[model samples]
Target: MQAKIKKVELRNLAFEDYKQLKNSMVESYPEMADSYWRANDIERLLGIFPEGQLVILVDGKVVGSALSLIVAEKLVDKKHNYSQIIGDYSFSTHNPQGEILYGIDVFIHPNYRGLRLGRRLYDARKELCEQLNLKAIVFAGRIPSYGQYSNKLTPTKYIEKVKSKQLHDPVLSFQLSNDFHVLRIMKNYLAGDEDSKEFAVLLEWNNIYFDESPRLINTEKNVIRLGLIQWQMRSLGNLEALFEQSEFFIDVVSGYTCDFAVFPELFIAPLMADYNHLTEAEAIRELAKHSEPIRKRFQELAISYNINIISGSMPYLENGNLYNVGFLCKRDGTSEMYTKIHVTPNEVQHWGMKGGSEIKTFDTDCGKIGIMICYDVEFPEVSRIMADEGMNILFVPFLTDTQNAYIRVKHCAQARAIENECYVAIAGCVGNLPKVNNMDIQYAQTAVFTPSDFAFPSNGIKAEATPNTEMTLIVDVDLRLLKELHEHGSVRILKDRRTDLYQIKKIEN
Candidate 1:
């Protein structure tokens, strides 16, 4: 036997669903009937700002509703009763230019309470708040269970207890869990509230992603999605095999809607096995022969897959000199290269390569970014210079032969993220290629690092792949968080730098 279908949806409030909405609110708040909105009031709300009125449906039944209005941030600064603030239920206080979403009411039917419909309504409201790019959501939240402790504790004391988890008030507890902090305690905020004793808590949830600048463009995104490919080292007979493998990873990451696909440095170096009879320097030089064609092919892959490709560091023969290089193959079919600025001692001794003298950030459709190859990230100055260029993300494509070497790259990359106040994503080659000279062993643990702060991961690592594993790590980092961190983080390392004491500047090559 087949089970019944249950479809749930959230949508703007409608006058036609007033009956269902009324039923849900009436049952959700039996203690606040006198405060319920009337038909003409709902009409006025719809007439003023229909978008802010939202409802959630469970199988075509209205199970929850959230009503809100935009008001100037200053309008909510002082104390005011619910009726006075909402203009006596007429919602005349709504200001289209306002940056705050003042929540008038939110309720879910008792029948659907077990389904956590309140959370659904709140999440929808939060999404709408972000879509409108509002500053925050403010509301007078009811503490229905306050009457139980009214005799023993003051409202402020009770709120403190609830916030500390020493006490539990269903409404306030849910709001606290949803990241809404109690701003203040209000006396006589509502009338005829026996449970709340005519008192309420002013709660607020700020939109950390909020922007003050007027949005002239609608499609711009502050959150960037990245795909890190932890490649395995394997010898191949020809270039076609390597291209096939590269395309496979690109396909997988793109399937998940990644904005950019990144491969580890020298991930294609296994092709060097073809010149095994030659010296290490000679074989790598031969590898440089494929750089131009590989870049063009990767460009095609980027456009075809609809993802930007960071074609990991390669050997480039330019002006009769070898330089390690990487390409940023944008989805628009445009591409640019950032040559590795610091060659490791092994790279210099084994391949007779010189580091590229040029240092700059690359501009993409997403935002400004910098690409550092292996040892370049080990030097704080390289990233510090790029950070000055307003780079949002720093990508490090590295290859390390052992865990110790990988740790140096990893730890330094993390430091760069914190000090620069930018996201740092690093990918590397894993596994081994014993048959390929100078590519005999590999060690890697791919990870995306975020600025160390309250808004980001506690340990600073967002997502990481299993050690020495051939896998893809896809993660999203918000550019807005970096902005907030720079301007208002607990420890503003980027802003607190003692510039007068020391400075980092790029010298012309």
Candidate 2:
């Protein structure tokens, strides 16, 4: 039969033809006979749907038919919209935002059964959806009434077979052949056949493109060793006590055969002593005099140890302005500095500091890395920007004085790892430093955290020094594993991000 396919006009169809279609459905499956026979109710539902969804022919007769509906789902603060070809009526929610659909039903006259009209109708609807740029698409298949008459299997068994790997089943091969994967089994959806269960599969096909070309090669060694030096001062009274502990921390760090060593924020707190007692100008001079010796010692240690050191954030007076910056020192004594981008409220209001507006991802012999000072890791943008720039390791330097704050710091590091799909190594202080003028106050507790499938994992701790004790925490980092994780979806939050829907601005340095 060479009948051409066209849109269905349910309202304009002759009353006799409408009755005949309904009777055919009921006759094909007695279970839905009563519900299918209700022409007035079906018309009422059809009236609410979008026009032109139900497809049929006009050979001066009501013959072939098909239908479709647009569908969507909201995800991760974004809307992922798609379309589906549902037979007969166009289904949709009034708001088009919430989850709901109005299914349009289409029925072809028995005389056109042998023609290829259904294929043409399905293809046309699919083309219309593609033109709309829908992200997700699907189609619902109801077990046709003819399945009830087939003796090869029971209705329940037949539906199960069609829904699960029975794509070759002549009744439902069209959907499977069109690339729909079974999603789930939904029951009791058919009218008048409320007792019967209907199997439904939610198949998904993605249209997003990944075009970035990144080249990464393997080195002879798969892992890199890192050492963390968490330093703190308990009070401003005992300056000698602070230096003594620093010496011990340095000693332990020097002893380690590490590729890199990191010190926590405000690594040396001597300057705060005079700042609290004198004017800003006088305090700056005093702090400068005292911090010089400490920094000279650190540079010497980095050179002697023959290891790269990220001399975490410190109160530095460079060209008159005091900045909280991290110094990246090479084994040859050459160094680069990075100012913290995101500062806490206290640092701004009380300390008279401004946050830096730069993202610095450094290239090193081991691999590309980024450094986040304390609070910066809490913001997704910090690590996200680094990831987008191809930085695979995030070194975090934090001075967490309290236990609760330490926990928050740990969680933030883990979140960064997941968001960036990379590795994170966070070093935080663990011990106390006596006040500059006093001899007895010291605080301690330091730890290191790494990236994990769930969050950042605390795989190793070099040492959590006693309240006044000093120590170095050294651990081997698997750089190869980090790269593998980013490639595989092991810690892949970034993989699920919908970049086309959102925009990210670069933080200017």
Candidate 3:
């Protein structure tokens, strides 16, 4: 008869499950004369690391358990025997600062055997290792069937045969099938396990996701150069003309040592010059028609220049509703869009654009970043939420028509930088668009901002272009410095946020 595990639930081991776990262990390993784990031993392991302890439940009852402890890599390198590593199953050497996970014990009830409960427990261990970013999972697995062949074959010879598929040992074979590799065989690893002649196999499962590179140690060495373009507005020409104009900036930025290039909000409004004779609403609809081609060109430009490009905010039509959207085109040929979450009165009243409801931060090789178009940056909550999610930089692309309008965006962006302890980069359209209807006037001074702390520039401005000039401003920001500020800055705004008093929760649509 096949074992049917009905209603199997996997969860963290709680203190209350100790009794059922003990019963399962006793029933699973009946061949042993003494208890595999004492009550105090279980309690000590749980007390030290509750996150590493997980139990499998069926019908609200514990059916299996897997316990693990973190240990230093050097400890595993020096110790060969299981008893020496685990300190006689007491887990006295568990280290919270360890970089490796040491699997102490895994057991399933006899009645629950063949139900793949052991596999589930192992999967949970693998996930825990990933979450902790551990180096690897190392454990001494018993060779239960080795005792029967002890008289005929040596431990090393037995292992070679099992590895070669000539023989099968229950524990080692199961581990091998689960992507574990045998490091070597150990003698007298387990004194009480007579089934394996007290021998064990040293096995390891590496966490491939764990990055051990030493690239991020020096914050100064990790710098991302950005190019901010204060694009000059001109009359709309053919698509070829607009493409050529964009390619010129891409070409110039590619000549420099920069990782990303940014354009301003409504940078493509110049393309709507032909329809400028029409009403404001008609011209916006016409501008939305070029959204797809603009996105494709930006993607191609990103790939051609081998640089990440924030294509800036454009009038985008989706599902018959227009939105102010920014396209993030990565050099790897992937792209994502960020819609303006907050619509201005002028935009809503004149252009029929509605505010977006979703907020997203894009993950890059440098770090996590978020995009907030003009009015969105004015709200403290938007930038605050992004900073809370580990975002190191916030990109704002604006289209202000007056000096006062520009100052509003500038002051709000600077305030966000100071409050969130994050870098803010703003790129905007400069010069006038006489032929274009609602977008005929423009004013901007593209600038990269930093937090107002000792670690950053005194004025909080990393680099800025001359006001209303059609030029690109290049600046290299250090990611390591941003991380350091979060921990040791003059003020810990992100860390010191009073969440107990008031919490900002996202209202999902």
CA deviation > 4 Å runs, candidate 3? 1-221
TM-scores vs. true structure, each candidate: 0.62, 0.51, 0.61
Tell me the tens digit of each residue's lDDT in model 2 across 1-509.
Answer: 33654543333233345655565455444545354535553454345433324445555454544433444443211322222222222333322332222223444544566565566555554444444444444434555542444455665566566657553454355556554555443343343432233433334432222112324653334477777775544553555666566556656666766778877777566546656566443554455455555566667777877777787776656666555777777777877778887888766654555677678688765678899898888888767888888787788888765667767777777767656766677766545544433212323354544555532354523234444345566777666555545544343666667788995769454
Candidate 1 lDDT over 140-222, as tens digits, reads 99899999999999999999999899999989999998879888888899888889998999999888668788667744578
Instruction: Write the candidate numbers in order of decreasing lDDT.
Output: 1, 3, 2
lDDT of candidate model 1 versus the reference = 0.90
Worst 10 residues of 3 by lDDT: 213-222
Best by TM-score: 1
Candidate 2 has a TM-score of: 0.51
- Deviation in angstroms for 74 in model 3? 11
List the candidate 1 regions with Cα displacement exceeding 4 Å. Answer: 1-218
lDDT of 3 by residue, 1-509 (tens): 13554588999998888888888788888998765677788788888999999999988888888888999999988746777777776787899889889998888887877888889988889889978889999999999999899999999999889989999987898898777888877778877899998889889998855656535463223588888888998865588788898889988887895778888888888877788678788889898988889899999999999888998888888888989998999989999999998999999888899888898789876678989999999999988888888788899999999999999999999999899888899999988977777876889999989998887999999988999989999898987677668755888888788889998767777
